[model samples]
Target: MTLLAENYENDPIDVLVGDWMSEGNMTVRAGTKISGQVDAYEPTFLEALQPALPHIAKYRIKVAVNAGAADTKKLHEAVTKMVKGQGLNLSVAWISGDEVLPQLLEAQKRGESPFENICTGESLDDWDFEPIYAQAYLGGLGIAKAFEKGADIVVCGRVSDASPVIGAAYWWHNWQRSDLDELANAFVAGHLSECSSYSAGGNYTGFKDLEPLGWENIGYPIVEISHSGEVVVTKNKGSGGQISVNTLTSQFLYEIQGPWYFNSDVTAILDNISFEHLSTDRVALRGVKGALPPPTTKVGITAKPIYQAEMHWFMTGLDIPAKARMIETQIRMLLAPHLSAFSHLSFQIIGSVPDNPTNQNAATVDFRVIAQARRAEDLAPAKFVRPCIDPIMCAYPGATPHLDLRQAFPKDIFEYYVTLMPQSDIQHRVHLSSGESIEIAPPAESKVYSKHQPTQHTTGNVVDVGSFGATVPAPLGTIVHGRSGDKGSDCNVGFWVRHQDEYAWLQNLLSTSFVQSYLLGDEYRGGRVERFEFPGLKAVHFLLKDHLDRGVSCTSSVDFLGKNCAEFLRCRVVDVPLRFLARGRI
Candidate 1:
């Protein structure tokens, strides 16, 4: 909201779009709806917009957001009431038809739509948990239709994260549906802008450069897109945070699947996409090819809520491993009678006690025991907490509990199931302020593309790393910058170098086998590791399938969403060329 007001005061503003929905968020919203505690939409959206409403109305700046979450109509009504209360005449519209739980259930009853999991190919019938909610990823055309109908604000539920930008550009340019290239470019711009400050340097590995600009208020990203499909990414003038090729590259790589970026509206070919540093705080993105979208759109289905709880213990000084094992054994032995009650349980020892530590904190490591079950009572004090805590009296030397009673209580856990449904099944609709609802038709041209398409690349040939001369053992971060993010149970890590010469060495070294065996190490569980090359950006991308153990909502891993995967890989020692090392660290 602060950025919105600042951007409006500092620069020309068109549409302000915000994304507040994710797989985990959807699961949470579904639980809220089922419990009837409050409206399923994101309340923060209203809280933030309430302060900025006057500026938006005065400037006639359009607003679009997926803050509607599981309930678009309710959010639309609230926004309408807010506008009327403020005496503003701005038109508000809501897009719907993303919710498909009832429809999916009906189809499943008839043995029609199997609702097969996209990642594991398991049918919904085989899923043991009861599904409470299902939402299809709608296209941007519905939003475009709302704008064409003279809407000043649009609220959406389950539209793709990039749909708002794509819709805004489509309406601004009055482009036809056949404008694939233009739409694809807008898709890229939307992607770059979706994560707010990311494109401007929020999660960038080059933290040293952004220090002078200050991190307190990193600038929000803005894409100045032209009619020719060229995009110049920038931010509010005088805003903190640097907008450079490296920063934008980091954002580009975050949360992506592979070379072919799929959306409901169009398929963006990212293999040939390139970026150019135009000036200070400005980068131009080009060469994003376009193709017809798939006949099906991604769908997220959330099952019945589970319960989880954890207890943390500190292992200090000598015999750290022995101490951890002893405590874990004592707890397990005590809980053996009730072991079958827990659906999943784990004792994770985080960090290692170093030799001759200088401080008490450095010598201490955490041993956490996590428990998940279908019933909250299974993880209650009697069954879960007491067993772990009772062992402290007889524990190994220097064993101490973290002493947080609240951590022992059970919390709701939502499990997400990702799949795809045909676009033909969706009844996309736009509800305008004029009391008329319009139906949005799916794209006439769409191709049937397989998700397991053979790995393709635009890079001509592989480089011989031996030709780079003498090498030194150093952290990969010295010459490379990486970004990682989650998509359901899967995670992607993208690594790139600044110099063209380094691209050859990076591409040759970070192969699928190498990443799986070395970078992932014990973390590389049973799953496929797919590698992709982006020559234009001098980057290599890897997708770790089923890496997050059912993703953020249910994953017990410390890095649940796998956001730190890239940093972990970057910290690993690797053979770096002496010449590349001389070029200075990232």
Candidate 2:
């Protein structure tokens, strides 16, 4: 709200859009709805909008947000009440029909759609958990229709993360559904802007460069889209944070699956996408091609909640590995009687206690024991806590518990299932402030492209790294920067170089086999590793399928969303050309 208020006051703002839905968030919200402790919708949006209501109405600024979560109607009512209480005449509208649980269940019983998991290719019938909530990813047409109806604010549920920006641009340009090229441009802009400060340098690798400017208040992004399908991305004039090609490049690669970025309205062929440095804190996006969207859109289903609990033990100083193994053995033996109750159990030793450490903290490693079950009773303190605490008396010297009673207790965990649903099956609609409901029809033209199409590339040229002279072993981050994110159980890590000369070496050195053997290592498991290249950006991207163990909601990994995968790869020791290192490390 602070950033929004400041930006609105200083910049020529068109519409404000916020994304509050993710795969994990959908699962969490489903659990929240079932618990009835609070409304299923995100209440923070209402709280944040209360103070900004006056300014919004005064400037006649339009607002769009997916803060509606699982209950768009309830959020709409809350926002309307707030607007009326503040004596504001802002017309509010909401887009719905994203929920498809009933339809999916009915279709499955009738043998219409198998609803196979996109990542694992397993049919919904094979899923052991019972689905309680399901939502289809909707397009921007419904939001655009709401805007066309003179709505001052629009609420949405389960629309694509970039749909708000697409809708805003569509309304502003009066674009037709067939304007795939223009819509694709807007889609790219929305994707960049959807994460707000991320594109403006929030999670950038080069933080030292942004330090002098102050990170206290990193500015949010503002995207200006021209009618001719041109985009200029910039941040607020006086806000902290830098917006350069590197920052935008990092975000562009974040959370994407391959070069064919899919959406309901159109598919963005990103093989040729490139960025141009316009000036300080400004960049122009180019070469984003458009194509007909797929016949189906992604749908997320939340099934029976899994109960989980954990206890952490700290091992310090010498013989850390031996001590950890002894502790694990004891805990397992203690819990043997109740082991059958848990669906999963693991004892992971995180980090290595370095030899001859300078500080005590550096010499200590965490031994974490995590357990998950279908019932809370299976993870009760008596079953989980007693086993862990029982080993304390006879444990190795300096064996200590990182005590947290709350984390040891059982908590609800939502299991997320991702699949595709035909767009024709969706009843996309928009409810206007004037009591009129508009039904949004599916795209007139659609393509039935194979989901397993051969990997696409912008260019076929490959340079041998051995050709680069006088190679010295160094961290990849010395010459390359990267960004990573997750999509269901799959994780994507994209690495790019600052100079064109280093691009070929990066492409050749970081092959699929190299990534699986070196970077992923034990985390690779038995998943498929796929690689793609963005030649225009001088970047190489990899998608590790089933990498994040049943997605973020149920993942046992410490890096829950796989956000650290890129950084981990960047830290790996690699042979680099001395000529490139002469330019100074990133």
Candidate 3:
């Protein structure tokens, strides 16, 4: 491709990741377009990938067929029989929609077309697409639009798992369109191998119960990188997942949904990467860390900008979930005596979950109810669910109403959770104008992410908040995901520090309103934080943002979901002063 990028030049890019699990939008290819958040049957090229798998020559990879369905021609004849006997170079890398849909239907029967025809969209039928698999998200803009079309190893199905090492660090080095800390150390070594079975140990909820965990052989993490974005992890041979250093420090706290999951231009500090199990599945990651935004990619962020409105109701039963939870707590006590009627009505109790012990009590319970309103008929839980099913045929005798309440489906749910904050935090444009900035080789790692300390997950940088939860105690392989499982209510628990000027004053006095108004009370007047990302500029992250308004949310997501969100945000910084719990809304 440009004669193998003018023969080698910067090296390092034999990447070949392929993760697939499909069912929907599989129309092979032709100028492909499934806009508005894309996903029209995608996955291409399997091997023969040669600027060199030419361990040297053997070529011949073609694959045809277009009009997809049936796992898009079996992920295109299993990647053309996995590039027949691997000797590939299919005229060097990228090409798949079953080998570019018979050369775009022989260039539209020889009209020598310009382009624009491929179609394939459908499957997101609003939430639960009933999908067993559906992949979309491909970022680094679809691997920089397949290396601007001269391709180089990029099969797909679901990307944005920190996109193929931020598309091999923005295509063969010299990378940097404004280095948000080297694209956040390549998006923190691709969010630790984007769910390839949680860095080789299989979604480890800290081994909640894993017995020699084979689970149909779970293995997948492999990120041997280093254009100085230094990552190591590793895996492939005899796969089955199980790398250690505490299973890669609990795979750096899976998903970590809070403190901030919003992305783009880096902030994933996941407790600053710096692992080292060296032997057993080989975990190294030697510093993926981040932070240093505000040189101006733009970030004023200190959040809480909501408008609120959320609703849901889906009931069915014979016992119809205790008569759909007494018609959802008497429709929030009959819309709380009509507060100027309908400004707010909140209630939630979606049932049938005991992890389905045959639906735990003979299966079949859908009394899902979620209501919130600043007015929308105060979130009509369907007018108190059809006058409580004729008093649920006089229920409560042995609780009846299981299903068939005249084939129920009665639906209505309006949404809103918007919270805004965009005044600036990341911005770097160097699109290469003013004559390639007089020799722009200055960024491949810019002397290893311009040193702000990235040792993978730890080598001690301390930011401790004591009584745990904001810890960075280092050496214990110091890796925490969301980078410390995204500090919402805090979790990388402690690394004892005295300065970076006490990080925004220990993050707004550990989320103030004068220290959570003595631990969440007095109409709990404080709570609102924008996504706090981290690839680890040596840690400092937080997220206990829940902006509870109207009424009730005081607490009980299992006494702190994940068995103790950093000990209830470190027992509000070691107790004493948090006496306010007279009524609720923490």
Error of 3 at 173 (Å): 2.3
Regions more than 4 Å wrong, model 2: 6-9, 456-459
Give Cα distance to truth, residue 90, candidate 2, Å.
0.4
TM-score of each: 0.97, 0.98, 0.26
Winner on lDDT (2 vs 3): 2
Per-residue accuracy of model 2 over 372-451 as CA lDDT, tens digit each: 99999998888998998789989989979977768889998988899998999999999999999999998888998776
Error (Å) of candidate 2 at residue 143 is: 0.9
Candidate 2, clashing residue pairs? none
TM-score (C-alpha, index-matched) for candidate 3: 0.26
Error of 3 at 476 (Å): 27
Report per-prediction Cα RMSD to one decimal.
1.6, 1.5, 23.0
TM-score, ranked from best to worst: 2, 1, 3
**In model 1, which residue pairs have backbone atoms overlapping below 3 Å?**
none
lDDT scores of the candidates, listed in order:
0.88, 0.88, 0.37
lDDT of 3 by residue, 329-375 (tens): 65455444443543333454444434434444444443433322333
Off by over 4 Å in 3: 1-132, 136-145, 148-157, 168-184, 189-384, 388-586
Q: Is candidate 1 or candidate 3 better by TM-score?
A: 1
